[model samples]
Target chain A: MSHLHSLKRHLVARYGAIIAITVLLLEGLCMFAIRSYYVNTIEQVLSNRVQLTADYYQKYVPGVTPLARAQKLLSSVDKDEVALVEVLDLQGQPVLDSDGFIADYRHTTPEVSAALNGQQHAWVGKSPLTGEKILAVAAPLCRDESRDTVGVLRYSVSLEQTFRVIQRLYIYCLLVGLIVIALVLALCYSLACRILLPIEDLTIAAKRLGAGAHDVRVRQRSQDELGQLAATFNYMSSQLDAAERAKNEFLSSISHELRTPLTSIKGWSETLFSGKLVDKPNQTQLGLEIICEETDRMIGLVEDLLDYSRLQVGHITLSLETVEINDLVTEVYQQLTIRLSERHIGLTLDLQQQLPLVEADDDRLKQVLLILLDNALKFTPPDGLISIRTRFEQDIVITVADTGPGIAPEDLPFIKNKFYKGNSKLPGSGLGLSIAQNIVQLHKGRLEIASPATGGTTVDICLPQSTPWTAGTYNWTSKANSTRQNLS
Target chain B: MAKVLVLDDEIRIRGFIVVNLESNGFEVVEAASGEEALRIAHTQPDIQIALLDIMLPGIDGIEVCRELRQSYPAMGIIMLTAKEQEQDKVSGLEAGADDYVVKPFSPNELIARVNALLRRVTLVEQVSSSSEELICDPFVLCVSEYKLYKGEKSIAMTPTELAVMEVLLKRSGKAVSRDELLDAVWGPDYFGDPKIVDVNIRRIRRKIEDDPSRPFYIETVWGHGYRWHGESLA
Candidate 1:
């Protein structure tokens, strides 16, 4: 019933009354045509029968017969041999009855009325009293030397046989029509729903997947269009899940990196403060220096986190200044000298003399360089050559190259992603490149990472050439050294 | 000889300042707080310099500096600060203090700054007292080097203790205290107490006095006061 209500809603929109009226009109026309044909054929047969009776009378009886006599003659004829024969007087009294009906000549049927009006008529309907189906036709008969209104002669053939034949034909046609309609409806419903179901399922499953439930899978039960859509959804979910897993792993590794340095600083500072190194000046100084360096490293990591977050939220405000790239590189190199020396990495400078000052933050640029140089030193073998080169290609290009183990081609694409490290071949916090890239981006600069032909990795920082200088780049190491020299 | 007073809570720091000042040829006096420095400044008028530490146990250095500067305009005052934060240094300088040096500072730097302050104060004092031949605290003298020209009676003294007496007689217009005598004659850290300070007074009195026991060239300041008994040079 609810389905019917919905269907009614659809049918109403496409003109329900017009469709019903058209169906009713077509049914009425069919009934009219069938009745007309039934009457015409019956009238033809009746007229021929009447004419044959007239011929028989004319040939066998060589004298003129009165109307009453003709009526008697017609009535006397064998009823079983005749389909239906009836005579009515001009005063409307039945003269002869056939098919065992006591005919009331005063009563007028449509066929009789038409016949009395000098037009022949016939009709098909159920019999009222006799309960036998019949087709009736009527016409006026005239007799005598002068034409006069005589009586009506009516004929009706038993229509039971025609009715049976038509009934059977209609039943067969209706059965075939119903079967065809049923097949069409079945095919339409299956085709429409078959095409629609998987799309529906895909939409539902995709919605669930979007809500972050990875276990949702579309059923690919067919080799049809919707099945292909389901397959695509499955592939997308799998890809998303893989990427999510990789991100989780990267976050875990970052946490480990953050915690390890923190643990070392905490543990060693406690040991140092406990006076275990009271007599050991060298050890005490080493411990203090290590604690200071580790604290700096932790602060750097936190700063990287802040920068990354700022970059993610697009909130970084660059304090741009005209900077000498070579000077900046030298500052970072000096700061990292202890580590670089320990790694036995010989830094060769190829700075362009009188290179145009590029617009950048000297400190932030130094930070970026430190991260990159630290990474290079970490991955480079002892006694490997590290080189700093500056070039101008419409902009300042500062490159730090080292003879370290080169990065794999696949890892290069993801090397700048947060906390993404290459398979732990070398130990790293994995934030160096990512932070460097973010800082470079903040300066409206470009960072390109590539493997040198000989070996190791090269990072190129390209900065714009026309930003303003807001402050001087003061190297703390140089200041301390100068103070020491002055004191000495 | 110029008299200097050192005020520091730390014994080692006080010794360090006193030793440096004495080596630079200034007569040095030591006090550990603003109160002691104030008390010493009130009685011993010969103090030429007052070095104060900004952080002190009681009556902080700035207050002592202000009081000393008010009482003795010729006295040089230096404030010592520990932190390099500009606020501390500026506060010390703004408190009527002469100069400030950050602590953990080099001893040479402190001495250099002290000597520079002394010269600036001395030069200003020289301009104000241009006609005065010698400027010393008011005190009486009985020494061999100079005759008392106060109405023409020449005072006499022995050469052995005469040099000691001369240091006091130069400041005869003011009270010549015991520590000043001890610092000039026997040297700093003389270990002997106020007795040697009294004994030196007795020895100077015997040669230059009319009576040894009741001599009145340099009068004893019992408890909290001292005076020159002969006469005022003015």
Candidate 2:
């Protein structure tokens, strides 16, 4: 949970801050537009009022004096509409003021000068009299016959009220921006929690798994990538649990296997060490022979363990050579026929003549045949039948079938896994078939084990006719092997 | 020479055992499976000692021990269990094996345990004929038939449990220490945990007493051992 604090901070800093800043910038743009609209309405109204007053003077109301005209035309100024109205002589100085004071209006500016030249103009600045902000508009007044400028009519409506409206809108915009920022931040926070909570759950599960809690699992909450991640994590944990169980089973069985030999070796060595056979050389020779056999049995089991580990890491290197399939099968058959006949189990061989030479490891291929034959021998009862057949096709195929009780349907799938002995009490470290499969696969071959309901088990080995024994074909690599193992 | 039966599926281990036992002046009968062992025992009543391995093919050693204890009450049974089978050791005892030897054991250790168990077994046979019926109220021990009666109602008992009941009944009203019971029932050379006495005693109380939790016939003497109250409780 503490690990999520930094993530939360990063979320707020990156995503939340970005949303807030964007909202603020939008609000500022809106406020500027609103202010311009409001101020422009005020300027338009003031300029229209002052221009109409000057037109009336030029056309109809003949001025007695500019001061008298301003006083008379004050009613047209519409005091509710414009703040102050003034008339100026041709000197561009105010001669009359709407505040009932003349010659007190202080400045002559460009607006009044432009109006004297018969151009209407407007400007906004601080008033000379009151120092208050105002928008002033001016227009030229001319004689009716001459159509020439005589005086200027100037009008102004103070901009103070417009500015107040703009200020209030700015406050409203900031309030809306704050609300928007809060909403987006809340959304970002929830999104972050939604994502991180599963990661956190996976982290704790992984920790418990590291601590050897095999059954630990997390809930799948959503259909996003995180959900897939959770599903994948559950799969990984289950696999680890199964592997752990398999390892424990292996330990127990291996210990039993090791002890059987040790019991023999220790018992005989103790008797031999006790000098019990001093008068009997024949008994001593039997003990020595049994001791040597038990030692070889242990070495075989140890070699299987070494081979299994090497296969896992892809470290087993095959010495590739061109070998005759017929000769190989015949050799294995000869080696095993003696044992088979001793047990009274019958054997038959069916061979395809003139088999093609394939690139393979001679010793490893022989090991595969040995494993399949050893299985057939273990399962087959006395006077049962065993057959070895070879076929030639695009790939050379060898099949070994036994008349033993066939494998159960449930046990068939797991036969290639290490140490899957399936309720058989016969003695062997169950690594033989698995190692054989790995070896055959390394030679561009596959081992297919099937048990038919008709009461027999058959193992088929198919090797490609020609796969060049190159470094690329067999990857003796660090990176590629790891990925392959992971995939397996 | 004492006769012994050595049962193991492994041929070399069986041969080793046969050779070792024969060298030590005991005649040996060997069988490779539980069914063969039972057949051999049936044929030869003189074989008084049996050593069975637990992980055989058809019937396990525990079940075989139960079968042997039922019919041959005077045969000394020893189980040869592997090291990882710690629970199997206790189960083997519960199934009426008198003692057990772990795998990879030295021959001397095995021979010592066998000699010890022989004393207890022979003693059972010797003591059975000395009495026809040993009775204390509702509980009656039938020696020759290897049975006990609760007021004409016969109850089932394994050989180990019967041995404990016999010892406690003979020494009724006297507080017998655990070591004395261990020596008398399991033999002095018993290379096993002494807790087998408690297990058997508890089993005995369950058979005789109406309420085993508060046993009246068999009384725990608190840190010392146990005493049979006899009719004193009645």
Q: Which candidate is the best by DockQ?
A: 2
Model 1 lDDT at residue B10:
56
lDDT of 1 by residue, A19-100 (tens): 4455556655665567568657776877777555534433442324444445555755676654777766655456665654
Best by lDDT: 2
- Candidate 2 residue runs with Cα over 4 Å from true position: A1-3, A77-168, A211-213, A268-289, A307-317, A466-488, B1-6, B18-31, B35-50, B66-77, B90-98, B118-234
Runs in model 1 deviating more than 4 A are A1-87, A91-107, A142-149, A173-216, A222-225, A319-342, A351-368, A390-398, A425-427, A438-446, A452-454, A461-488, B1-234
The model with the greatest TM-score is: 2
Native interface contact recovery, all models:
0.00, 0.66
Per-residue CA lDDT of model 2 for B1-234, tens digit only, reads 899999888887877777788888889999899999999999998888999999899998888888887778668898988764658878887787877888887877788888877766665667677866678778888766667899988876655666777778788788888998998877777767787788778767777889999999888999999998964322
Q: What local lDDT does model 1 show for residue B216?
A: 71
* Deviation of model 1 at B199, angstroms: 91
Residue-level lDDT of model 2, residues A1-488, one tens digit each, is 77687897798679978998799889978998998787777778877877788777767674587677767776555566546788787886778777767774545777887887889998888877667788888888877878788788888778887788889989999998999888888888898889899999999999999998999888999989999999999999999989999998899899999999888888888888888877788878888999999999999999999989988788777776778998999999899889888999998999999987877788889998988988999999999999999998778999999999999999999989999999987778899989999988888788999998888999999998865555236533345465766698
Q: For each candidate, give its TM-score against the true structure.
A: 0.50, 0.79
Candidate 1 lDDT, tens digit per residue, B1-234? 788888877554564455456656888888977899899999998776677877665688888876776566446667776544567665665454555665555556666667655655554455334433332333233222222223345443222133355555555647766677655544453332344345445655654567878877677777533455544556
